[model samples]
Target: MSSIDSQTTYLKYREYSDLLKVILYSSQSVLGAVPLIYHLKHNNQNIIFIQTGTMGGNVIHYLISNGPPSKKFIELKRLTGDYTFVDKIGTDGMSLYIPILELEKSNLDFP
Candidate 1:
């Protein structure tokens, strides 16, 4: 519990992929999806909103699944494995917006 963590609002992601699959990968692998779930589980999040604006499939999978996207979960799974926990990974064609402040906050184990 710290000042910045309290002032935080929503966790926004931009990459485009099956929200469900991405969430899964993010959870087990500590990818983009981990931040939101971590905040929620810790009661540190104010909102869990994707920044990509293109969402539908598994809007809440990050809190459900325990692994990354499966081959069946994606049409081109091979193209996404390398990007397992990255911004452009798994995305068909999307951008990533990682907040510098938020990212810095992730490294700090708040007391």
Candidate 2:
């Protein structure tokens, strides 16, 4: 498994779980969807803005922590024409709007 401490731009999975609890409680809803945009300070250095939403009962987390684009993902993005995955987050990172579960299952990485 990858080391959570090595990640600089995104929160650990457990942290996300905690944040999801807070959002669910504060929003006071358990049926529909709640979208959230959070500005997080990472390691007291970089400021990263993460976008997430709750759908049905699942928390969908966008990942912007893959660092830079790998040649394989770039080619896949080009072939698929899914430029939406290249969204800019904060000042430097690019975002990929994949569901948290799918992200965990796939080995693909993006910028």
Candidate of highest TM-score: 2
- Taking all chains together, each candidate's TM-score versus the true structure is 0.21, 0.22
**Which lDDT values do the candidates have, in the order given?**
0.32, 0.31
> lDDT per residue, candidate 1, 1-111, as tens digits?
665444433333433344434544554553345323222222343222322212331222222223332322222233343323333234454333222112213322222
- Candidate number with greatest lDDT: 1
Q: What are the root-mean-square deviations of the candidates from the true structure over C-alphas?
A: 12.3, 14.4
Candidate 2 pairs with clashing backbones: none
- State the lDDT of candidate 2 residue by residue for 1-111, as single tens digits: 344223323333333334344334433455534344333333332221333433322323332333422211111121222333322222322322322211212221212
Regions of model 2 farther than 4 Å from truth = 1-14, 29-35, 40-111
**Residue ranges of candidate 1 with Cα displaced over 4 Å:** 10-62, 71-105, 108-111
